[model samples]
Target: MEFILDTVDLEEIKDGIDHMPISGVTSNPSIVKKTSPEDFFGHMRKIREIIGKDRSLHIQVISLEADTIVEEAHRILKEIDDQVYIKVPVSYEGLKAIKMLKAEGIHVTATAVYDLMQAYFALAAGADYIAPYVNRIGNLGSDPMELIGNLQDRIDDDGYDCKIVAASFKGVEQIKNAFNYGAEAVTAPYAVLKQVFANPNIDKAVTDFNQDWYSVYGEGKGICDL
Candidate 1:
């Protein structure tokens, strides 16, 4: 499974990549507003430099119309490298944009997917990835895992070359459940992902191990010192 950070914070990106097995970075207009970069394209370029070309960088389009969305996709490709995945929400017009971009061989990620029908439409339109809002769906009184499971079944049964990249998580269990339900990847906040290591017992175990090591080798001495 792939773990993607759904934020545009520069330091968080660097630290998350350094510490965790980060596969990519994802950003929406809201996420961008959090960082409020002075130069948008330039900041995205900086992110590309940090993550390198091998990893995926998903950037969303602000336009709502098909023509403008397609235009925005091209501009994003021109501004950032061509390898960037253009994130289009799964709307009526967004599907049209996805079809056009796919025809031109541009990578497209369908976002803001809520209904199973919407995801199916995006898959039919040739979206490379379909992001279902996990927590949001749950908050709406629906089982997000059921949606993910059904979507995965459709993908496997139809032999679609699309992946389910579940998004909008609030806690770590939700993330785990997403993967358990057949999500190939998930994009979550760095702080939420870091909570996987937040249990006090984990810290206590490490501290005890260090104390025992120090008792034998003395304080301030590491294995390298020997």
Candidate 2:
């Protein structure tokens, strides 16, 4: 399973890479608004510098029309690196954009998917990743796990190269649930992913183990010292 960061903040990206097995970085217009970078392309280039070319970088297009979306994708590729994954919403127009980009061999990620059919459309359009809004779907009274499970089944049955990169998480449990439900990757805020280590019991257990070790070894004399 891959852990992807869903924010554009450089500091958070660094932290996520250092602390977690971050596979990629994803950003939407809303996420960009939060950072409010002065130089859009320059900032993206800086991100590429930090993450390097090994990990993926996904950027969403603001255009709603198919032609403009495709145009924006090319512009983004020129502005950023060509390896960047163009994130297109799974709308009627966005699907058209995805098809066109895929035809040109551009990496595409299908976003803003709420329905199973929308994901299927993206898969059929040959998107590399399909992001389902997990918390949003749950807030809408739908079972996100079931949706992810069904999508996984479809992918396995069809042998599609597409991966389910679940998105829009609210808490740590939702992240775990997404993976448990067969998401190949889950993109979440750095803070949300870091919350996996937030439990007091984990800290207490570590403290207890260290205290016992020190009590016998007489302080600072760990196994490495021996």
Candidate 3:
């Protein structure tokens, strides 16, 4: 029901987190590259202070080994707020880590998904969330929309808790399509979310409505003399 800004630049993320209706933040290696080379925990500690403990903050692990990944997940969660969600990939190692983490009562986000099958696999593996790279899949000559559609249908028809998190949104249209496909949540860059509400037509319509209201009555006076 809320949009999560997928960015690593703390300033940019903070800007959106402060003004926009962004429910959370998701970041991967690529996103991290855009941030500082400082310690990852340092970054998360600052983020926790900015977002508070009540909000969800997703942080990905660097380890590919299941044991290492699980350990890293625990360490990361301990450093950040209690709402920090771990991001696990859809692989054999990731599955193992997810199972271990979930058993430990740590929330896990199954990321790097491609199709409905992967989403199903994530659910079968018992992940708390499923992140499908909509635009990245589109770039691969695949219909991410259809993939998400089938995923939603299958999940709702069977009643699964693995939520669909639409990731890698390229534009505003992609955001709309992800919503239409009934993605539980969509993670996009701050720029994309900013463009989502930007439209010349909406601007013109608002101006026209204001002018019409001012004509009969007065500026900022939609109510008549009473």
Task: State TM-scores per candidate.
Answer: 0.98, 0.97, 0.88
Q: List the candidate numbers ranked by TM-score, top first.
A: 1, 2, 3
lDDT of each: 0.96, 0.95, 0.84
* Candidate 3, 1-226: lDDT as tens digits: 8788887777887898888877888888889888754888888787777777766789998898999999888788777755688998888788888888888888889999987787787887778789999988999999998988898888889888778889987799998998898888999988888995698999999899889978878877766551
Q: How do the residues 40-150 of candidate 1 rate in per-residue lDDT, one tens digit apiece?
A: 999999999999998999999999999999999999999998999999999899999999999999999999989999999999998999999999999999888999999
Candidate 3 residue runs with Cα over 4 Å from true position: 209-226
- Candidate with top lDDT is 1
Clashing pairs in 2: none
Give the TM-score (vs. native) of candidate 3. 0.88
RMSD of each: 0.9, 1.0, 2.7
**Model 2 misplaced regions, further than 4 Å:** 224-226
Q: Which ten residues in a row have the lowest lDDT in candidate 2?
A: 217-226
What TM-score quantifies how close candidate 1 is to the native fold? 0.98
Show the lowest summed lDDT stretch of 10 residues, model 1: 137-146
Name every residue pair that clashes in candidate 3.
none
